[model samples]
Target: MSGGRAEGPRNIAIVGPYLSGKTSLLESILFATGAVDRKGGVNQGNTVGDGSAEAREKQMSVEVNAATTVYLGDEFTFLDCPGSIEFIQEAANALVGVDAAVLVCEADPAKATALQPWLKLLDELDLPRFIFVNKVDRASGDVQTVTEALQAVSQKPLILRQLPIVKDEIITGYVDLVQGRTYVYRESGPSELIEAEGDVADALGEARFAMLEQLADFDDHLMEELLEDIEPEKAEIFRDLTDNMQAGNIVSVLIGAAERESGVRRLLKALRHEVPGHGTAAARAGVDPASKETVAQVLKTYHTQHGGKLSLVRLWSGSIAEGDVLNGDRVGSLGQLMGQQFNKLDRATAGQVATLGRMEGIVTGDVLTGGGEAPELRRAPRFAPVFALALNVENRNDEVKLSGALAKLMEEDPSLSVEQNESTRQMLLWGQGDQHLKVAVARLKSKYGVSVETEKPKVPYKEAIRKGVTQHARHKKQSGGHGQFGDVTVEIKPLPRGSGFQFGDSITGGVVPKQYIPAVEAGVREYLSHGPLGFEVVDLAVTLTDGKYHAVDSSEQAFKTAGRMAMAEGLPQCDPVLLEPILQVQVMVPNEHTASVNNLISGRRGQILGFDAREGWPGWDRVSAYLPQAEVGDLIVELRSLTQGVGTFTFEFDRLQEVTGRAAEQAMANAAA
Candidate 1:
């Protein structure tokens, strides 16, 4: 991959925890590669990656920002992924097309836990990755000790590629352990190589040997050489490091201060020499590069105010042209994505990531093939929403447009879900966390031109009878046209829980017309919809014992009116009770946090059913409980806080349980309001 398009572009993603300087590192890399004249800071908000208005205001990336740049005679496309857990899906989506990733993180040992989620994901994907300990200037503690702490969290072995050169408690530069050379930073330019001839030299030798030991564990030949006590050549050492990394067996650690542009050149050199090529990533994506069939996978979807839809895709096997028919639809004009700006392109070669405009139907994670063949792929897992809100548009007229916009939003990011709660009559938007929904709201306003609001969904509380009541109701009205008369004696009684509503009648001796019996039952059913308790009535029975009617004036309408009157007067007298929906929740958290989770459930008035080992997940316990629907609004927030942000659970509606005390009082008050 050269600057002149001689080789295919190499895709590299920069990912890490929030505020870990991933965007800053991207800016430093671009600056060091001469792709940009100056580096951009997050606070200044001029960085190429955080270009969106929401990102600028928040001073962090909220989505994946892919920028194409040429570095050291190689074509490189860098994917800057948001680090917040709220936007993890974006990072995971971008990883599908990238050859490798730069795991950016701080050097604070206390923050080592923050990297666990990303580490687990990378290990799951088996993608080759490098850890760039970013913001070293702000970091404190020995680099080796910090690396050890990180090692404990990472499944893959961590190899120290370079050691920080600290002078008087300050990071001055770095020493390349493999080459035994020291380099001093030169301010936005290339670092100057210096002689490693003292304590730095001694430390370099030891670190280099340690790195070799980690690498040798994966290479039999290297292990033999190490056991024989033979000094391995630098060429052999580099080859083993490169091979093991490309095989996803080891993670090489590098340190850098992206804000100062320090250690960026070394990071660039490592990327240029070590990152895997497109063919390897293609094979992993289940694509055959030799097949010569045009294939592409959408990494993202962008809806512009004027440009319609642009599907950012990566061509895996063959070239994509201005009007090539891919899968089903004809490809629109190809455009090269350089940061936030889009440049027109006649065609994009294999392995190049570009945007295809007017792709109205295409969505993220959709695989487009020339021959319409099913691409062997494990569909990218949808992001499980940790929080939800009852979403609504401001204007009633915008409801139709809002649904359409949400559909497109869902198409763009499958991590989000939209559901209509039939009982509550509210539309719910579920996603990762508050920030995720905030970005979605902003996009709805800016791109789709729709304004939306969100609130906690109303709990679907129900009402049921507690006591039985018998009453006589009469519908008698004498109009000048005809005399209307109908009378009924009915009984309302509570049934066993879960028995649902039942209607029965016993009209004998022609006391009431037989044809009017169904109309009486229909009236009873309609009145149940709006019970005296101001909620859906359930688990109750209405019985008709006897009734009288005037033959000439007693029509079905009159009989129906009489039955409704009977229930209306008798239900309130029967002692109606509020019933709250309880959910059968299975909360899965690390065993260490089981006590906290148990406390959380109990505090919410939940009954602990039992706890057991979570199926298929080691070291995690599943605590089953029954909790009221109202307490589940922000359960994910507390669970994450208790378990270092790794806890999750699944739940279903269990049954309706009678609620008492202040909870019932508040529910009744809210329903009245």
Candidate 2:
């Protein structure tokens, strides 16, 4: 490393909204740095970022792609993260190990709303970041407006470092605010340095002064120099920029179009001079900097076709080599990963990200130490699933393999989960969105060789009685010398809303024997499993007022049959109703979209409890409502669409409420079918 900086690679994550050209930026960075012989295009499906078959088929990033390059004698690893909100977990997981992030965005002000979530996440991590307003060549508006729009969503001040040079209403080049020089774009390679004249020459001073003013907010020396109207030395100004950026005090903004490889070298130079080293990331992740132990945290996990499992990890404190025992598992191999390619490493030191092979028991976000003690490292937060699908194995022989395949998928991606719904009798796969679950299914088929059928998960509906009834029934059979006889009289009544199922007996002393009472209760419970409404019965009480048992032939099986007969005869007489699970939901969104969320809940036949400003979150609101489970299946998709993909919610089962009309009719029809 130069200038006395620590010797290690600078890990940076390229993140933004969908189609913001993050993968394109990685390709350009690699090509510009000579790490790759030629740049690859996203549409051509030859880029190192989206190399997976699933990503190529969808023409979008489905996971995090790591590529390494060198610029100006400093090593850098660029993690090209998926930009779609559906795959945001990939970015969240990768960011914990990175030194900083480059947030790429379009120049359109209308799309500024999409940057809020990414900004909020970066602020939470307190990671240094820079904004690259991409596609300036295609922008139809002024670059200042785009900078202002970005500033509105970011918590840190956005200091614009470049001024676009516009000609005939099209952006042709940019003036470096720091260097006080102008450059013209070269379509195939690095931009050409040019002399500033006319409009560019006149506008350079004001823009540069404005950038220095923002930087001075956190630097006392710069503030004094600005106050005295004295120009600061260029080296001093660069020092202030690097110091503030590494401290997370300000965000440096630059302009570029990654598809054309414009400004990529300039971007790399900025990174080389300003980006914090892996030491800063290790300290930020709560790793003990003074400790000499070998600690590494798994950032991502992948189960390869023929290579078993490979865990991408960031070594925090010491070096590790192949065959080292980490967290009770032997490290089979160690290497650096570039997309699908692996470069074998003799040893990996602290602050370097490496891939460990065959870490079978290890998972994403797991902290491993070769010293046998696990370090407490910061882990990525697990997102609550917002979408679900019920799976059916296409081949009966694959049924035994589904669980193992799903286990691997969940291991590779902590955001994915699987559940067995006892009431609905369906195996449900839960994820962030419909596309998220779809990609998971594709992986199961392609990667694991397990074909499956998927459908929307069935809501677990229940049944409750509206009234009470008295009924009597008997079971008698005469096949041989002894006959089976069981007679009973039961009083069935509806209880309170959440009383569940209650069973009691008030039989006279000699009429029914004591041994037969539990059998009768068991019989009642067995019948309740499927009520007249074709659902598990709940919120009702049953009393066995009287019963007759033949001394010779009466049995628990006979009494159970008698109880089932009585329920089949009595429940229809009482007004049977469908009861659906109601969830207590708290929907959190930006205050600007609060009104839309209220209307959304009402349209879904929900009851709004109240709404208030969410604590600790400024300019956001939490709306509390009671929503039916059936209506909640696709609520997240609509909520995100309404709030620019920033809205989310948490829910729990509150109670079972009676449902009628078309919703109840549909539930009944589905049950019958």
Candidate 3:
């Protein structure tokens, strides 16, 4: 590891959409800072931040990876977050503890548009951001065109820090606008300042003037000097840009080919010179559980194979040390994380990330402050499970072990949820997408030595009446000592949708007597809970008009039998209908793929509620639709495949729609079988 004097670390997270080369950029930064001997590539599966097995296998980051590097004698701790939306919450959590963000973007116009949400998030966080236009070496588009496309999606003023010089589609080097100097990369791997002449000088001068103009907006003196044609000092320009950035008034855009390490060194140098570190320790106000004192936030929790549990924490105020007991809002064990492992640190100071080991009763979003007060931390990102699957242990005897393994998996990824439907008796695992669940199951086997089978989860369906019917049922039995006799006349009527089930006793006094009335209602409820169609019965009412009971053998059992028999006989006569659940879904995809998504939704018997272009998203739109739950089982898989893994959606249970014709017959047949 590289060593440097710690003077208030500047924690910055690198974030963007997937395949925008975020991990590659991080690797280049690590190499440029001399923290690593050589840069690692994603394809080679040797990058530091993309170290997880799942990430390596998928050639994409699956979690947040942190490391520290020194640039220009300043220490900077960087977090490289996964780009897939399935793991986007990881990036959002990292955002909580960071001071700023470096938003990486691809040169493609469409890819640049996909970064709008990330840019908007940074804007909302009010953190100064720098746009790194990566993959310049392989870009076929013009730099100016890409910049314009980016500007369309960004609300902040985008100030160009560097201008690329192209020769036959090759980015030879970049001209530093702030320094008014041009550097071309030589075979030796270091940039060399080259003298410009003629048209080249004019073009460079024009670009320099544009950058100077942007900086001048932050300083009246510079603006006046520019109007007077008086030259401004290079140091003054740098100061203005840095000040504007810190104030969140300007966002600097830099161009580079991170894979080739072309302008990576310059980018790092700029970060060190421009980005400011934390100023002072102050008590960050947070809700206190024990008392009313303020507290700090817990940003990350890691479960390592060798390191145990580590809670990467950021102290907002006061002081914390080893053995200093702290309580979390939610009950859990607390521990500090260290480099894929955790150790109990004796103590940690404010504004520092420390690993606390084996801490009981702690969680990721818990606060620890003075006076034994612990408050709930900020809300974590919540993405509804858009896809689900029923899972069963391959070996029947391993059921409990499989459940335990899944619990561990859930602990690692809070986005995942597991539940067993009582009516269907299906063990379901829900996640953001197919890949998300696939990875979860893989982890279950690899980490816990548990194996399981997965299939499309069954939709929780119901059977309801469309019309009313009246029927009579009787039960009579005679045994040696006693005789059983019961009879009932009941009217079953269809209730309005969502009214649920209701039972009423309208019988006259002394008819069946009030004693056995409760028994009849209970029986009706039991049968409704599992409807005549073999599913739960809903949206109906049953009323008891009259009944008879034998004086010697009348009992609750006899009445229950008569009630159930009456319901069984009257339900089939009332025109039962199978109701399937529908889900309201919002799908986000590239504009080019929007039509395809609409067609796919229609094919699934979905109704499009319409679509609108998303704000600040240049080439994307959000499509609103309602689809049958059954059709959405693998919708995410098909969507990702269609959009090259750039599409995502969120959905929730909407309402029940009646299945009709052949579909209803098939469902009923399957239920009966």
Winner of 2 and 3 under lDDT = 2
In candidate 2, clashing pairs total 0
In candidate 1, what residue range of length 10 has the lowest lDDT sum? 1-10
- Across 467-495, the per-residue lDDT of candidate 2 in tens digits comes to 99999999999999988989989999999
Q: State the lDDT at 222 in candidate 2.
A: 89
Q: Which candidate comes out best when scored by TM-score?
A: 2
Kindly give the stretch of ten consecutive residues in candidate 3 with the minimal lDDT sum: 280-289
Give the better candidate number (1 or 3) by TM-score. 1
Candidate 3 on 246-360: residue-level lDDT in tens? 7788899998888887787787777776765553112112322233243556666666676555566666555566556666333133333312433344555445555555554
* TM-scores, all models, native as reference: 0.92, 0.97, 0.88
Q: Between 1 and 3, whose lDDT is larger?
A: 1
Best by lDDT: 2
CA lDDT for candidate 1: 0.84
